[model samples]
Target: MFYLTSGVLFLLVALSAPAYAEQNLLEGGLLLTAAALSVMALALILTLRSLARRNAKLSRQKQSFQRLLAETPGIIAILDKNLLLINASSSLKSLVTEQDHSTLAIPVPLFADANGSIDLLPEIRQQLKQQGIWHGEVWLKNEHHCEAFKISVHNLSSHQGKTSTYILFGQNITKFRQLAAHQQQQQLRDDTTLLPNQLLFIEQVRQAIASCDEHYPSAALLILDFVVASQSEREVRLNEQQILDIATNLKLLVPETLLLARFQHNIFSILVPPHLCKQYNTIFLNQLAHKLIAGFNQVDSQGMRSPLRIYIGISISPNDGDNVDLLLNSALKAANRASEQSDSALCFADSANQQQAPDFLAMEAELYRSAAHGEFDLYFQPKFSISSNRIVGFEALLRWPSPKRGMLPPPTFMPLVEETGLIINLDRLVFRKACQQVSYWQQTGLMRGRLALNISIQHFTQRDFLRYLQDTLTEFELAASLFELELPESIFNHPTIWLRERLHSLERLGFKLILDNFGDGISSITQLRLFPLHGVKLAPALVKYIEQQEQQRNICATLIRLIGYMELDVTATNIETEMQAYLLHVMGCDCQQGHRFSRAVPAEDIGQLLLKENQLLNNQRQLAN
Candidate 1:
């Protein structure tokens, strides 16, 4: 405004004094030039002030960009067009040496070749030029250790569309690689003993077989099955401490170079390379087997040797059919055969033994067909009251009189039946049959007592067992009081709540529940009292030598007394001798059933026995009169 005001006043003075201007034109021109110079000076000052403000703003932005580059956790760098390092983030410094910080071009270690022969920089540059970007993993080695980085590089273009510089970004992936490797290793190892699991073991076996040749003709696979023996008929399981001790002992006996793995519960496998058995394969394996057996004979707290048995089975490659599955199956079959024999604890795979092996598939199929067609019969064994010498009840026994294999007993096929999960079906059949027989006997007006049927634990614990029992009895038009369910002592092994509820349900239905084979398993008095049991049958083993062995007699007497005190009826089974029955009767057990009275017979024979007992009672009454 000052310059403009001065210009306007000067113009007005010059216009008003034209005659004076003509007289002093040189002086007026110099005055006009001075005014123009002043205006130009003021414009120069305003432009300088605006430039100063813009420079200050640019400086603040430059500082912020520098701060972000310095503090960034990821690696960042800027390289000139010639690939010389212009700037880099602070995180990049840790991955490089001091010399790398001072150097202009990218560090040599970033593109180091694994074989120290190839250079990767040319390839990277080519990719960046063609695609405008490059990405891959790179390994960098410092003084302390090596590190892995996943890096990406891009071409920074100028305003004229030409490549100006290169921008690089990287992430450290060393820890991630390590964690993935650790997880893979864990997946291939057993959690309990930290040994290679079955999956890894099979891989090793396959590798061994693939590497075999004529020079190395045979490799050995040994399957060691460990068993703990107890006097009781129930299964004995090894505790954690016992398992650890066995593993430790086996490790000491075997060489560390061989692979040892836990194959299954109570089973261990050892892989012996062909080189170890090149000269004396049999001698070496036999020695190893003996050593394993001796190691297991550890002394217990009572200073007595432990009852641990080790069965070793050996199968050689190429001779035992070659592949992983074939070798494993052959070894298992050998181990099973070793277990069956009493004299030998070790066996080799052979064709004869393999032929003798039971075909479980065929047996399982036969069981399914038998259950579907109702091709089974029940035999009744009369239980007599020792005091009155009269028939009280009959225990129903399952018998399969096959046309191909006649007179097959329960022990012959029941185990397979249970294993194939067909026991439930068979039990249901027996129950329905028992109900029908009792109903018929009642309709004919024959004197029939409570009929006992052995019920499987799996069958009895079924959710619909009670309902089925009620429905079946209702169909037969019979009362539940005519039936008795004999359960094994193993029934107590189930959840207490479930077992109690099932037993209570049966009791509520007016049926009697008897614990069979009471003294043969891990049964306690507490279990006996916990459930609603009407009686318990003594195991046949306990009554086998009660007449000859005084110790056996005393044990039975004590058990009978204990059961009698609990207000539960005691029945003795397997009484084959007259002396056995007399002794049991003297011990206060009034009910007995065994071959001494009669072997299991058909329903018609049972009717005759009942009639004979009634006639004897009548004659005795007449004699007393």
Candidate 2:
């Protein structure tokens, strides 16, 4: 450094002395070189400073990353091509067999065969061996631990000039399994009381299948359902949970061999072994169904009146699916189809391919269009007082002039519409048409009695069905009293606030409200305090089955005795034979409807009947006076 500085000073002195005694080019060149060297030295100093600052920044980043890796609690691991773990976080130590030096290896095997189908496991293992990367859930077994984890593995190139290695990140999700078992407990309701729940009796069903080690043993899944016609929010909330509970109780009674779960609000899924189904003895299945239906009548431990329903579907496996998800899905589809068809229950093995059952989308479409376009017509059968033979009222029974089919009765498709939410529109049309016909009858001086229309409570409870009724009544220019809205005993269900308000409003406007098919369903009469009803129509089932089913006849007798004290008028529908009419008259039934007097007739037939009756009554009165 001293020599360089001395050269610079000497050159400067020569240049100033005009070295060689002249202003020569050599002096000029020496001074120029000195000036250039000073600028180059300054540039070199700045470059070195920049490099040092960059190195310091990089070192800090490396330290920060190292600290993060050491502090993270989740399972962070690296494995070789063989899937043998090389590195993992300390928290994952318990997941592995501890080594002498003490480190962790998060094993992957606890998630194996979780859904009972793992054909992909072996294939994944082979790919991971070859590629050094894989991602999925796997079951890992240790002496004391078994758990599930979501894992992701990556084949990473080595930074330290070594062979590439695998890095994995996993976090045990044991809680997830527990939650899965519990989620549906809240989603679905019991069929009877409609409680929130489903603990699919898996162990019982699995054991049953195992017990039948010899025969054509297989498990079947059943789904059951119920549809309420009320659309009031108050009714829905009150019923939703109890409905789930009812479904739960229903699932419980289908035999230990059947794993029953409340899969939907109105549906129950039952898993049963094929051979355990009693060797084609359908009566056994029907017995089981009856038992479930009966069980729904029990007052829950909470003493909440559980007015529940039971609809079931069964799907047997190997026949349905080899895996749980598929089997469960198939069973659900079959159950849905059964509800649509109003079948006692359905089997997944025999249902339509599109569903676990043929959703009969065709039937549903046909019914929907027919109902929506008012292709279906109503026929009013006179509901007359037996004692006075007075034409007090008429029950408007819906009749579908199906495009491809003849007149379809209520049992044929009312259920489908109710389940599909199409009944709301259908009911509206029925109301308007019935009212229009009644008005026409009045104009002909043939109609002096009120018209009764059945209201699907589900329409009032689950959907925004109020508009339809309000609009139809306005369009027909019919007084509320001119029409009597009929409903099931279920309408008296708990939490009747909204239902009461709507019914009372309509009642005050002069329309009468009636309960049809009242015997047995909707056990709670408390809702009646809120309902402004004019009468109850004994369900046709009660009357039609009376002679055939002793139990049904007795129930009808009891209802006839009790309902009157409540001051509600009674109408007997489906009084087929003269004998049935005598029984109804003996029971003091006020009015009757059935083939005994006349079948449901069109507007023209009713008009003529009403006109003739009026003329006859006038003549009788004149003669008596």
Candidate 3:
């Protein structure tokens, strides 16, 4: 308002002065001077107002910076060229002692050395001077504990382009470090027994082997196979308590200084150091094995005699093997040989026999390479309908033609495949091949029947199994009805609710489900009724002697009748002779698949077989007419 008034008055005086100039020159000059002074006064007022506004803006920016430093999550501090504390964030105050705060230097709590000396500060400063930045992890002393901080220090330059101050940034990494340590520990432990797992055990073995010298030239590896004696050769399932009890017993028998680990579900391993091996001889090992067997022979908590049998296999380093994998494998091979013996419960790896044993590692490597190169072939065995005397379908079997071995059957490689969890990949490969063959047959009109695929229980129960089936079918432009999934009878071992739902999902997708290898295991009629099965395939062993033995024949006939009464399509497998086929047909088994009809042939040979069958059918029709 004052500036406005002055400007108005100056303008009015200037206008009036021009008129008075002619009358009184002196009076007009004075008026002009007064107008000039008023103009200067207005300019000064405007400059002051502009300066005031700029000062207010700087004030607000300073307040905002102080607030940011106080509220920040991490530690932030500023130090002068002499390393005296110039400013610190609220977080930094928590780590600084009262006496240190009074000194105004870098806080002592930030140093992790024994005497609370800032030994790292000189190095940090040197790095900042050379590179303008330094970053590292440092341990900081908190109130009751030490915390890890990832610290970053930057050189702040002045207007003269010289380092004038330092800016320190710290992020607390205590929780992250703890979490990483926990995860590393978890990787070395077994989830069930809480013992060091295979990875850790292998590392320990490697270390022990490397530590061996002339004084202690050998280490001992013992593999204990805990087998439950039963009527059948099927795998024995032991509950968690039983497994723990077995582990506890082994621990008591063995010394605490030795390393023990669970190699597999029913297999445990012990590693004796080289010094111990030098102290104990073969006789000592034999006595220890006997002690383990005798200790487990006593009755159980239920007051019944324990059926657990212990087979301990011993392998010595520098004799059986010199490395971790070789030694472990030698022990495993010895354990397998011991399990086959009926009288003895222990076996030592003999160097002579070791030469004849198969190199499982080489076989495993070859199998993996073959699978990668698609060296596997599928052989289709035709399933004949006995009643109609026509081809109903074909069961697809996987065959590996190894370059070393002439032809390897499923039994030779499948156990290893399943053990290594490679069965999932093989199962997918088989499914795709079967779908492609079926699609080709449909396109050429060569044959018309469903193709049965034997799926492993692990692969069949996968969460993506149904989706994979749908995708493969869609890719081949084939219907699900053209495919049949032959699941093993062991699939019934899973929870009934989950198994039923999974089977029903497959059924809903239009694929037929057949229980494969029926009567191979101890499957009951009650378990059979719980599944949504379209058919059942008799295990070859169940009907192997049906032709000669009357008792076996009666049992086969009864099983066929019982299955027929259940309204299921029964297929008898491995029909090697005409008598077996005839017997099965007369016994109400309409479907038969075995060597008697046709051996498993390649996909290309299938077309010729179908053509021959068609020609035979045409000739029969003409004879009937």
Candidate 4:
């Protein structure tokens, strides 16, 4: 209104003033001077009036803007194109508790931490100057605080001649970020039987592989599925949800450090650190394969086959693919190869994998047929007491008697057995064979040592497998103390409760339990507290160094002392040379087992060797004499 009145008065005065007369000099001068004075008064009044009106508008807008800024959700602020908060709302104001400001605006970096990397102000300024917009996410940190935020700011010009900045807006977005983190956490399968979503599992694999460069890493993706997995048998209901649940349960059953993801309905991706692989065991990977099948067969209480009983396939990083997509694809196809015909897991390693699926399928069919026809046979190797040079036990080793391929080691058909799900029966057959041999020896007084049977990580059923084992022992009439079981380091992969119960039962039945290839498999040793054990097998790696290297000797010596202190027996495996045996004797490994004595042989040969024990253990007689 003031500006309007001033503008009207200026217009009236300009109209009323007469034009300067051209002919009369005095009159012309007088008229021009009057017009100039009126014009000057009008201009001054208009300037003052315009200033007053602008002030009134500012006062109103300022109150409303303040209200809006204060009430808005999250932290909102007006920043200079430099990200220096020219004005801030109450939320941003509260976050800036340390700084004393009459008004609520400040620099965003004030909230950031020392040592935190920030590409904030310059980037914001550049975006604002060139595009007039800035938008993205940023992480801000302080000694006491750190936060993730989403921000957006726009460039604006002020009316003042000075390049004045407009304070824009901001919202904290902290809750949204936390929600995202929570969602990411759900990828992990918990003991509560919660299945990790597919997205979460992939992230875990990527994270595991990412650390491969700096730390221990190797992955064996085992895809368990039906050997003859057709669409379905007419009576067999394909409950996808239940199958997924079973898989999730299996994942939860393993150790926390392991990453378990459902690669597909009948496939699982297990990212195992190379050392954790039981392949390095003295018993080797084939024996490990047998053990896994035995354990997996117990997944159900009734006789129902578990959905988790799928084929096993593995693909390593860089060798399979550097990234997840290519690696998973290759692994899954290998799993398919194992599934379609039944060969445990095939690594995407060689030209043979590139061979058509049909060839592998036919190959799987033959392997299963061979197993069913009793193609595998058992061989026994002796374990001697390092101090006594007395035979204390024998490990039952497996052989594949192939008609076409001749006598093949367990490694030859073991992968195929795991793939075909025939290992469960194979374990049973091997155990029975070993039991019969031990029983035969005990009856004839030809064997002095116990028979050691290797156990699988998966063999502990919630139901009583120990009872069935006892029945077998009774059937064979073998003394309880004469049977021992060997377990690989992967036993830690099982649930604590199940393992504890099974071990207790075995102990109660008087069977000794020993760990095979101890130091070789663990990054950090699995706590012995979780297990009931009689002895441990020092891996060949430890024994190899015990001879020539003082450092290795020290390590072996320390390990022996540690094992002795706990009152647990120690056996050094692969005692290939007399020097290794001497070291074992000096270091106090309770037993020594390897080729230095004899190659693993048939049960009859073992009986003959036992008959000549006095010849083999002359050192003991000398010590006694």
Against the true structure, whose TM-score is highest?
Answer: 4
lDDT string, candidate 3, 362-421, tens digits: 677788998888789999999999777788999999999998986889987786687667
Which 10 consecutive positions of candidate 4 have the poorest summed lDDT? 280-289
RMSD of each: 20.4, 22.9, 22.2, 15.1
> What lDDT tens digits, residue by residue, belong to model 4 across residues 1-625?
4544555565556555665533354444455567667777889999999999999999989988888777887666766544666677776665555664536445665323235675476776666666676677665555455666676776566433234465455556668877876666664553233456456668766776676653344444444443323346322443666565656556545555556655544445556544453332212222333444554655456766643344555566656777778777766676666555533333233344335322445556667787677667898888887666568778898987766678878766675565456676777777778787777776787676678877654454425457667888899887678877887787677777877877887899898888888888762234664578888878789888776899989988998888788888887778789988887787777687899977898877876786687775675668879
TM-score of 2: 0.46
User: Can you write out model 1's per-residue Cα lDDT over 248-321, one digit (the tens) per residue?
Assistant: 88788887988998788788899988666553355456556656766776788889977787887888888885
Please give, for residues 337-393, the per-residue lDDT of candidate 2 as tens digits. Answer: 665664244444454432513334456778877765669777878877777766877
Cα error of candidate 2 at position 344, Å: 26
Quality of model 3 by C-alpha lDDT: 0.79
Worst 10 residues of 2 by lDDT: 229-238
* lDDT value, residue 100 of candidate 4: 42
Better of 2 and 4 by TM-score: 4
**Per-model C-alpha lDDT, please?**
0.79, 0.64, 0.79, 0.65
What is candidate 4's CA lDDT for residue 455? 65
